[model samples]
Target: MNEIAVGAHAPDFTLTTDSGDVLSLAACRGRKLVLYFYPKAGTSGCTVEAHDFNRLKADFDAAETRVVGISPDPDKALAKFRLKQGLTFDLAGDETHAMLEAYGVWGEKSMYGHKYMGVERTTVLIDRDGKIARIWPKVKVAGHADEVLAAAQAL
Candidate 1:
């Protein structure tokens, strides 16, 4: 799959959310969507990212933007992570990697001299018309949510 570019249509998907509800990108039309992809649940980087997003949920809501996290973890794992982290936003499960592939975040990664197939820390901001507004690829955990918030606000 090709990486989604700004001004292109965001690939829509329907996935089971951590709250046991079906979440589709198309369903979130008419609002800015912050779709973030992380490597795994409960990991140090993932946790900090989730927490940061959680902390800014109110601000995002005020900006009329919706935030959703995506990873290959199952719903059960997402539930535990959400509860443990006190996350207020939705976490969607992408166990089949369809969404990840569509967004072009699932790819080769290396850690500690070992290579593996995993999610690249990435975030996509979709405009109200469902077009990709901005993309943050190879994201650093620090101050990421704030950056996303600024982008969403600008859109």
Candidate 2:
């Protein structure tokens, strides 16, 4: 599949969320959606990002936006992470990395001179019509959720 690009249709997906509920992107159509891809649950960067987004949940709700996080972690791990972090948003379990690939966030990564495959932190803002509003590739954790919320509010 061609890489998802700005102004293109956001790819639809269905994944089991931390709450054991199956969430489909199609079901979220007609609402602004924040699809954030992270490497894992409970990690420092991921936790900070999720916590920030969670803290601003009301802001996003006021703007009529929905936030969904994606990671390769299993449902059990996601549940623990959510509970540990007090995150109120949905954390989708992308065990197969299928949705990650669809969003082009899963690929080769390197750290400490060791190359391996992992998720490249990214955030995609989908508009009401399920179109890509903005794509933040290789995102920096700090202040990212705020930026995304600003874009969603603008939308």
Candidate 3:
């Protein structure tokens, strides 16, 4: 898969959010977006990452950016995770992995020397023009939301 580069037009997608509303990238065309992909829902790292983004959601809104998280988890799991974590942002289901492939964040991963295919922790900052502004691949959860918020504010 070719990695999406900065300044490239973000691929458009429509996925079901935890709220049961369909969210389309085209609908966010004129707004800055913080589209993040995580490996799973309700896990430690994923939980922290979602909470971090949720905690700073107001700041993101102030910066004119909308944050959305995507995972390969089913919509039910996404809904439960969002409710349990008190996340205010959208948690979208990508069970088909189409969005994952389009964003090039799903690939080989290793844990304890065992290889597996999964969604990499990635955050892509899309400018209001709908172009990729920044990409954070293999993201570290701690302080990552702040970093992405800073980038969004810069945009």
The lDDT values for all models are 0.94, 0.91, 0.93
- lDDT tens per residue, model 3, 50-150: 98999999999999999999999999999998888888999998999999999999888899999999998999999998899999988999999999999
> Model 3: how far is 22 from its true place, Å?
1.0
- Give per-residue CA lDDT, model 2, range 1-155, as digits (tens): 23899999998899999998989879998899999999999889999999999999999999999999999999999999999989989999888888888889888889999999999889999999999999999899899999999999999
Q: Please give me the total number of clashing residue pairs in predicted model 1.
A: 0
Ranking by lDDT: 1, 3, 2
lDDT of 2: 0.91
lDDT of 1 by residue, 37-134 (tens): 99999999999999999999999999999999999999999999999989999999898999899999998889899998999999999999999999
Candidate 1 lands at a TM-score of 0.97
Better of 1 and 2 by lDDT: 1
Q: Every model's Cα RMSD, please? A: 0.8, 1.0, 0.8
- How many residue pairs collide in each prediction? 0, 0, 0
After superposing candidate 3 on the true structure, give the runs of residues whose Cα lies further than 4 Å from its correct spot.
Answer: none
TM-score of each: 0.97, 0.97, 0.97
